[model samples]
Target: MQYKSQAVAKPYFIAAIGLFVGQILFGLILGAQYVLGDFLFPAIPFNVARMVHTNLLIVWLLFGFMGGAYFMIPEEAETELFSPKLALLMFWIFLVAGAATIVGYLAVPYATLAELTGNDLLETMGREFLEQPLPTKIGIVVVALVFLFNITMTVLKGKKTAIATVLLIGLWGLAVFFLFSFYNPVNVVLDKFFWWWTVHLWVEGVWELILGSFLAFVLIKTTGVDREVIEKWLYVIVTLTLITGLIGMGHHYFWIGTPEYWQWWGSIFSALEPIPFFAMTVFAFNMVNRRRREHPNRAAVLWALGVGVMAFLGAGVWGFLHTLAPVNYYTHGSQITAAHGHMSFYGAYAMLVMMMISYAMPILNGKAANSNKSQVVEMWAFWLMTIAMVFITLFLTAAGILQVWLQRVSDSPLPFMVVQEKIAIFYWAREISGVFFLIGLILYITSFFIGGDKKETA
Candidate 1:
């Protein structure tokens, strides 16, 4: 089937490149802040930089989702997007709004932004409810609703709702739920409650749908696997993720001064969270192994494989490591949490988005497939980033454990400041390792524009 507009995927590709560049810059700033506390502050404070980094990561991944949807929806539904122009308009509006929010973050102080927006970064590193000032908060809501409306209307009018479309709708729900955090009454307890609604629900809940669907799409395309079989696996993985994840929000409540009953609820459900990621690992490899024909995009397949394995390790194994209330009690707000967040989001979400974009680039540009050399470069970048992230996670995990042992567990624990001094080496190690991750990103970004030799189809 012909797409109504030939340029269906271009906007998403551009957004992906911009977001990737943002991710790298943010990484460098955050790494510098770790090693050198007084690095680019006042002009670009660490807190503001972090906000941009984290928020942009989310935004770009969403952009990647939108791109993937635009690229794949036509093929899946056997028709074009209901309105390509509307999709383009939604892209610009969201982009402009996202940029504005970043500017607001830099301009407003922690206290002022918090007071204005209701999101108190000073108190909790910006995990408070969506309470940004009225204008900024409203902007976020409007952008989200507009995006949801566009995607939903497209699906409804096209009369096409496959696994990919289902995932897109799930993403729309995630966007809407995030808006709820903006105005959920002014109680700390309730604020923390709904904050998880946005954070936990998105990552663990709806976004997993996006991840599963994208991975399934790539695997089926590259491996010549039967669509029905691959899609069924997609359904199973997302179903399991939501089943456990909704309850897993209790995990955060363990320390947030909520009911004590959450310890049981959170521990049990979160402990079970790894089951679906394990299923995903099995799903990807099994589909590849069972393929009816070999495809040219071996690198995309490799990335699909990497997503499965990494998701299992990052979201499953590492998550299980701290699922217990007894363990989390000591490691609650430490670097251990950072370890989990980095790997899980990067592995399960970020890399999957990258894989989707990588797959689409060749198709959109009319290349038969990605060049072998570019694929090799991407593979190297994957390893570089993966290994570096592993080192960072290990360093922080060890340091967090040590901190807990010395500061919380010992009979005569070391002073907090003294313990921090002891762990400074790990912080340095983390920063040094981050340099490799940055190098990987550099190579990955270079490859997109300066791609290697193209294959000529017979």
Candidate 2:
């Protein structure tokens, strides 16, 4: 089956690039606001910056997933995408909708956006059905469904390989599960309960499947590791991820006034959640070490290896530090949680996606590999961003621990505002470290436009 589609990878690549830039800018804004307090308002408020930060992370990761799918599906299925034109169309529509939604978030206050989108209307009336989280939730559902349909149909028509098929099914599950959050029950407890259906399930659940498959795809292509070896690791990683993560959702319910049983359930399962990430780290490095062929794209290899190590530190180590109910009793909603979230997402997911893009760029552009010079620059960017983020996480973790001790554990607990004042230095340090991250992003964006040397020359 000869599969030919105009490289669908390019658009998704561009989208990923745009979102990466947006994320860095938003991160800087968020960091500055933390230190400067009254910085970049009206033009870019703190809340707005935060919204952009979170939303851009999700969007760009999705873009990476989509692009990776486009690149991998044809090879795995042994056939072209079912509808290349439809895939292209969905790309544009999603981009436009995502941009409009971001604008809506910035242009109007949260309350106003809710009202403008009829979320408050439904809430005010007896219906209570359309609340603030509803319209945005609906938009996400639509986008997820569209993406699922495109990917599923393509897979259905093509050859079925373990890696590609797992990703396809995983993404389909991700889309379907996200829709459950829209019809949140009337009970506040239940609303919070179901909210994790989308948030926890996607990130910690099916998205792990997506990430595992993506990592395996890249490793297999770049390292020329035995297919059997790589696929086995992928299977083991996903199996462990699912076993621990599904039950780990109970962690969120710990302080939400849910049943007491969740104390044990959440803590135990969440504590065990790091095992798979540890396994992933081993998998990536072992494959690279056992590679049968050498690739000139050392930057991509470095990023892949970094993803593993960082995932261990960010997701495994830092996450377990607070997963226990005893520790979380004080650290909930503190900067410690923020620290873990930032590094884990960037290290495990974002780095993996970036590695995929870097690996795919050569294949998509019909080049054997990127130039040593550009690869070196990108590798530097990776190290810079990775190191800066590590510093940010550590500082925030310290600050969070301080806040928790001062507010929750002190002899005479300080007021929250007073605690903020106490931690002001840490915030300043975080902002300064974020400057390094921004610099790394600038280097990364610049590398894309400035073409790399040919593989033969390199």
Candidate 3:
């Protein structure tokens, strides 16, 4: 709303929320498939549903990040976007390509889709998160480059702030690290090694920078905190994140045929990964407590605090539970890992994006904040989703603990399938949580249409 060009973010946010709905729907499907393996066996097997579920997560978050950047950059830079038209064009291109990729996943077998999309030339298709075919991968790179170019130019041409600078570093790092996905090695160990460069580094590393910057921006606006004070917190966070995140890559090296020394190094560094998140929690609360003015977007402020606490618990505390070399050795790929992944992602990235949306959407629509009724509804969505995710994580953690006990630690180990049957109850609990999450999402979208008497600003 500060600059005309910021309007471009509207479509991006809309698309992100739309795809988010799709992601949750697919997630419910995957959850059902967990209990009933043949729920959609031939038509939409577990693997495909999972692929769609995760791919939708990555894509929608990207959309949210891009939209947040487009909205924030102009105000931070004190100027208009460098090229709104180009930004809009890239948005459409990215959206179409993403949609087509999902359609491909649903329309044909994985092998056929890979072949049809030139996966033979560069075989990045079979990787866990980088399952996009060559064309889609290429499209992502192009869109990212153009998107970065637009924002970077705008920053260079205008004023630079700590938030914007850190955001640029995070964005640039995101693109740089993604290149590792293309470097698939023939050796399984080496492949896993480089794959973590993309996977682990992303969620734990640069993405945190992005998270920090976005949180700082919201805190500054909502709390009326001094930029200098927030920037100090940002500096400490960036330092801790880099120090802990970079060497923390060793954590994944423990069983991957790496040096024996990594056992000590990975444990030490990865254990410290929680420090930055802890600091982020303190920073969010401290700012709100010291607020200069009460912003009308109380819901946005709630989200800001939620991201802090949830990110700390999900990414920090739960992560620390199994992050050490000793614990991970026993629970390497158990449901515990899945628990960490689900909570950490939702807390850190998903909620951060929603926070940005909650704050910016009202301003974008020419108001300072939505009516109190609308905000109350939004807050309900927040609690429902956050609480539901917590239950999901807890149930998975329980399942993982029981699994590790019965399968790995026991004298007579049970088969994987047998163990899965035992854990069916936990999966059932998680599916019920998923239904609540979907309802929360529905309420979130519904909030937009609910209007009332409110102050209007231009």
Candidate 4:
């Protein structure tokens, strides 16, 4: 809203939410496939639905991070965007590529899609999360390079605030780490081992940098906090982030054919991974408590705080639940991993983007905040979605524990399908919670259309 170029972010935000809705829908499908076993049957198998669900989540969050960057980078740098035109162009290219890729996944067999997209030449198919064909992976790299250029040049042209700098590091690191996905060695064990280089380093390392920068930007705006103070905190926090998280990559090594020492390294370091997030919570609320201005966007403030608390609970507490090697020996690959992925991504990445959208969208719409009624509705959506996710996590955790007890720890382990049958009741409960999540999605989408009198600006 501070500059004309910021308007480009609106489309990105819209697309993110649209794809988010799609993700939740696919998620519901996967939840059904878990219990029903034939809900979609030949049309959409569990794996296909899962791929769609995860791909949509990734694409939408990328949309959000891009949107958040496009919206905030210019304002933070105190300049017009370097090239709004290029930014807009990249938007379409990325969107089209993402949507087409998804269609390819659903329309034809994955094998055919891989063959059609030239995967045989590179053999990047069949890997978890990196299952995108060669061309799609290359396209992603291209988009990332262009994006980094756009943002980096813009920062050099104007102010280089700490928030912007941290975000730039994050974005750059994201591009660098993703390249490891292409390091598909003939050795399957090595391939999966380094795959964590892309996955774990992302969520635990670079992505946290992005999350921190976004959280700092919003706190600075809403809390009327000094940039110097916030920026200094950004430095210390991200430093510790790297210190703890880079080593935390060892956690994933437990499953792969890595050395035995990783058990100790991963367990010790990864346990410390929660500190920065907890610091983030303190940082957000502290800034708000000392606010010099009472921002009219009470809903935005709510979101800021929610990200903090939820990130700590989801990423910090839940992650530490089974992070150790001994505990993971029993619980690895259970629904517990599912539980962790859902909350951590939502709290850390997904909600961070939505929080930025919440803050910036109101300003973009020519108001300090939405109508009080609109904010109330948005908050309602927040609680509904968040609380439902909590239930989902709890139910999955319960199922995972039972699974470990019945299958892994017991003297006579049940077969996989048999154990699944035993846990069908929890799946039913999870499906019910997912319904509430969908209802929240509906309410969240509906909130944007609810118009009310704008808050008075002095």
Candidate achieving the largest lDDT: 3
- What are the C-alpha RMSDs, in order, of all predicted structures? 3.6, 3.4, 1.8, 2.3
- Tens digits of lDDT, candidate 4, 73-160: 9999999889989889999999999989999999999989988988878787888888887888998999889988998999999899
Q: Please, what is the whole-model Cα lDDT of each candidate in the order they appear?
A: 0.77, 0.81, 0.94, 0.89
All candidates' TM-scores?
0.91, 0.94, 0.98, 0.98
Candidate 2 structure quality by residue, lDDT tens digits, 1-458: 12466377668878987887888788888887876778977777887778778878888888888878887887777777777887788788778867886787778776777667776544421122122245555666676677677767777887777898779767987887766645547888887787778778887889889888988888888899888898888889988999899999888899887999998999999899999999999999999999988987788888889988998899889999999998899899999999999899988889988888888777666766766667777888898899999999999999999999999988999999899989999999998899898898888866665565433211
The clash count of every prediction, one per candidate, is 7, 1, 0, 0
Sort order, TM-score high to low: 3, 4, 2, 1
- Per-residue accuracy of model 3 over 192-241 as CA lDDT, tens digit each: 99999999889999999999999999999999999999999999999999
**Clashing pairs in model 3?**
none
Residue by residue across 1-458, what tens digits does model 1's lDDT show? 14654255667667766876787678778877876778987788876787777877877887787777777776666556677887788778877877777677778776676676554433323453242445555665675676566556666666564675666767777777776555454588887787788888888888888888888888888888877888788778877988898898899899877999999999999999999999999998899899888788776787799899988898889888888899898888777888888888788987887788778777776764667777788778888988888898888888888888999889999998788788889988888888888888888766665554443210
Better of 2 and 4 by TM-score: 4
The regions of model 3 sitting more than 4 angstroms off are 452-458
Report the CA-based lDDT of candidate 2 relative to the real structure: 0.81
Q: Give the TM-score of candidate 4.
A: 0.98
TM-score of 3: 0.98
Model 4 residue 411 CA deviation (Å) reads 1.9
The CA lDDT at 367 in model 1 is: 69
TM-score, predicted candidate 2 vs. hidden true structure: 0.94
